[model samples]
Target: MNKNQDYEIFPDKFRIIMTGTTFAFFAIAIGAITLLRTNFVWKILAVIFAVLFMIAAVRIFKELWVKTPAYVINATGVTDNTQKVPVVVPWAEMMKIEMVPNNAVMQIGILAQKTVTSQTEKTHVLTKNLFTNGNMAFYSVMIDGFKYSKKHFLAIFEELQRQGVQHNPKILVSGYNVGREK
Candidate 1:
């Protein structure tokens, strides 16, 4: 593909839907089972947990209904649409691309130039407290439901860097080679 060609990555709706539904189901089961407990504290705690899980499930399922590309990469920059507000990181301002693994989920963190913090001051959920090396980033997309494997995902950015795309930020991938299949 040409350097100017745009690539869009959409979330896997099926996997995400199933996960959301499973969480909802577990929440219901927990709430129901707690009814059998004699302790009031246990019941209250279980109810709270159930509500929180259900809320999370609802949010997760919303992703299934909203059909939008999570990430768009092109010659100009990488646009992250995963958050409420789209974050546009131009290649020149992109300082680093860090692949951080958390709880079996892989999140791609796009660290842009420190000056970009002015844009991140917005009240978006992803714009808060995302500090790395005294730099704030608003781009973090989860790849759990993506179609490509983790290795392929990393390769995409690496290839762009190798091709010497504009600025070509440093790509750092961690916790990917540990017991993970290609």
Candidate 2:
């Protein structure tokens, strides 16, 4: 495969700040729970929340420590290296390419002509359901502002269009609107 360009979705200053804040919140919550004299049910809930938040904090910390490219878009296809098992979506199999607004960030959604398999499917039914979005099968790639600006992201989309894939202009516009609204 001819790898044309490589891009790294590095965490921006905003992301770093958010991650630090979340971690601090969780740490404080855990400490408060420990110090407070609560009922059994409340204690259990506190433990659960603490564990979940700790996990999330650890994940974010790992990402921050390990700086790697989240994805690699090549001449033939795009490969997602973020997951344990890399997902490679070939250009020929791409049915649609559009911008999807997610949590104040614009993500590039690549829908395949057929069902694309990934490591998540082997884990649980719920995971597969969440990833597939109940039949609308596609992969979402976050375009980090630190790594790529809107113009660069759009240029990449234009290049994909040149490869014969058509994107939904409405979706793209809506994504931009969402960014503006935020």
Candidate 3:
């Protein structure tokens, strides 16, 4: 158990910046390429997609500028601030924590006794029985390009689950090829 009960995981700014820049680049490239086309409907569709991507890029950059922790776990609960719809599930509500692999990404899926929602909004509970199909989670954190290693992040949660909280929620290891981590 760590001396400090609170664990805060910040996003890697460099990676975030790169991702945002890529989105922006694509938006510009797509819009520019479509300008050469004569089809009016195609141009409209391309412009819409470019605008959407630009919006996403702007949001990402804004989040990076804010510099908030992507994930936080403490004696009280686990808070996921990765998405626009932030969710905080207390230890008592959390039933299981699992490592769900989706392609090249490893996501920390927090399964609660019920659907966990944001303070204001009612977010959907996204899972189907132990997450066998790897559909979604009540709350999931993508562990790609974060400052810490996947093993370290998982270890922190495991330690917190064992020593920090009282409910003793199970932390299960799922998915294939779990040992590999960079």
User: What's every prediction's RMSD, in angstroms?
Assistant: 4.9, 6.0, 5.0
Please give the CA lDDT of all the candidate structures: 0.61, 0.55, 0.62
Candidate 3 runs further than 4 Å off: 34-37, 82-86, 114-123, 126-176, 179-182
Residue 179 in model 3: shift from native, Å?
4.5
Q: For model 3, how does the per-residue alpha-carbon lDDT over 12-114 read when each residue is reduced to its tens digit? A: 5776788899999999987885869478888888899899999989988886766677777777667778557666767766666665665556655666664
Candidate 2 lDDT: 0.55
- Winner on lDDT between 1 and 3 is 3
Q: List the residue pairs that clash in candidate 2.
A: none
Provide TM-scores for the models: 0.66, 0.61, 0.66
Identify the candidate with maximal lDDT.
3
Residue lDDT tens for model 2, 1-182: 23245433444445655776688688668747866887877777777877777777777666656656676665656666756666666666665566655544455666555434455663443365345443433344333333345655565554555443322232222224333311
Ordered list by lDDT, greatest first: 3, 1, 2
Give candidate 1's whole-model lDDT.
Answer: 0.61
